[model samples]
Target: MPQAVICAYARTPFGKHRGALSGYSATELGAMAVKELLERAGIDPASGVIDQVYMGHVLQTGSGQAPARQAAMNAGLPVTTPCTSVNKVCGSSLKAAMIAATEIRAGVSRMVIAGGMESMSNAPHFVRRARRGEEVSYAALESVLVHDGLKDAYTGEAMGNAGETIAGEHSISREQSDAFAIRSHALANKAWDEGWLDKESFPVGGLERDEGIRPDSSMDSLSGLRTVFSDGGQITAGNSSQVSDGASAVLVASEEAAEEHGLPVLARIIDYATSGVESHRVMSAPIPTVRNLLKRNGMSMDDIDILEHNEAFAAASCAIQMVLGVSEDRPSDIPIPFRNPCTVLVRVRLAISGAPDQLSR
Candidate 1:
């Protein structure tokens, strides 16, 4: 099989609620990130190098038309370059990248641009067509962002409620959740301070750093945050992931293309698989999926240097940790650490290979 490698990537700093990025639409942010990636790598999308563009988006809200095509055109890519949008919820962009890689591996596309975008702050409310009436009476209006994004149609369970249920099953406590949030913020803050993320971040609307990190946050402050779901639930506003806005993109190319263009390869494409958990226990899907990925690769948790799980709620990370028998300490063992910033959490298991020695150091 042919190989596809991610040559370069870029992303905009995650904007806080109604922050600087509010003015731009999700498609614009996505285009900005992709353009930045191409600029840094000196690749011209109009040069016939890019074969296709794949974008993942969860909520379009006010953004109109085909977001992927809009994003590619917005990024100055030739209109002739075909584009497709993938909406796999949280893993939309990641899945978009996977799709791009698959196309390259299948020998169909030589080079492709893949990424995801979201504008949670701009999520719009709408009234169904059936709700419209000739009378000037108030019709029922539903929040498309909330109902379609967070609420499960099958069980009508809000994502927060699902987190609470998972917490109860795994005995994850509020204190533990708080601690995990604190650690995450601390790590994020440290990374920002060290300028480790500068390589991948693009300046957008004057927001250069992640707006969600609370450097001064402590256990006391976290403990005081009210529970967001159940009356006695372990999930709290502080422990739960923030509703953020941002976009990211990566340039995937086949081995021949990469060598011809003199682009350095970071990692090779490996096996990818997905699984579905019960609607009530949706967060546990990663447990079985990761297990299957590892099993297919003939490896286990001990063999994985890094296992990046999307932390939608503190309970989610805890539940995955418990089921996978993985301790948090092992993450540092990997040479490249991934910090995912997305509302929907997609479990990605990357088996690192072919990284330069500078990264290992």
Candidate 2:
């Protein structure tokens, strides 16, 4: 079996909700990242070397038909290239890459473009039952972002509320969560200032930097914010993931293809696994998932050098750390502002640094 490796990757700087990147649709953002990936990999647009395109996208209600196809066409990939849009919610883009790697490893594809994109700023609103031809006094408008992207379909509970439950179960305190949020922002700002984030990102919509980082974030400030999920919940807006827009793309190729094209192999895809837990314990899913991944790979937490668990809420990260026996002081190199899109960017950083690290989210 051929090994799959990442040859190149690029991402647009995450834009705050309704901020710099609001003008572009999700497909447009995806196209920009794909274009940047091709340029960085030194692949000519006309080469037709790209065998497939797989892009993850949520909030696709009004984005149109075949968003991945639109992104590929917009990025100048030959129309002959096949495109797939994945929708595993928060894991969409990461799962896209995983699918691309599986295809490459199985010898079905030689080269592929895989990543994720989202435009929360432009996610559409829906008038529930408006098209039913029923006489109603009012039509309720629902946020597609919340209804589709940020809510648990099975339980109808908001994701933040789920995070709150996880935090409560795990005994994660407000102070601890606040501290983690503060550290995340501080590290993100530092990464930007040190030029680490610049290597993997390209300017988009006149925005060259991530707009969500708060340089003045402090425990005092975070503590004062009221909780949005529950009456007295510890999960506050200051410590939760931001509503942001961004895109990321990576070129995945078989080792033989990389050698033939002279493309640099960033990192090899050793293996991947997925697991599930109770619906309401969504935030705790990573705990068992990571454990299964490590067990299957015959590795332990001690053997892993870097971990990039999603910080959807500070409580999620705190819960993972506590259960996995990871130290609270462990430093994360990348600032994960958006969910699926930023995963590819983190992989880019890992490859560029030439570290023998394993990433889990």
Model 1 Cα lDDT, one tens digit per residue, 1-361: 8898878777788876587777777888888877987897799867878999988887876678898889899888988999988887766777887898899999999988888877777888876665456343245667767777888878887877888888888888888888877877787788779876677677888888877778677999989988988888888877777777778787888989999998877777777788987788877788888889989999988886656666578777877787789887765321111223343211222322213323576
lDDT by residue (227-306, candidate 2, tens digit) is 98898788887888788888889899999999999998778888887778887888888888889999988899988666
Clashes of each: 1, 0
lDDT of candidate 1 at residue 106, scale 0 to 100: 95
Q: Provide the TM-score for each candidate, comma-separated.
A: 0.92, 0.94
**Error at 137, model 1, angstroms:** 5.1
- Compute the lDDT for candidate 1: 0.75
Off by over 4 Å in 2: 136-139, 329-331, 334-349, 352-361
Candidate 1 C-alpha error for residue 128, in Å: 0.8
Candidate 1: worst-modelled 10 consecutive residues by lDDT: 345-354
How large an RMSD does model 1 have? 3.1
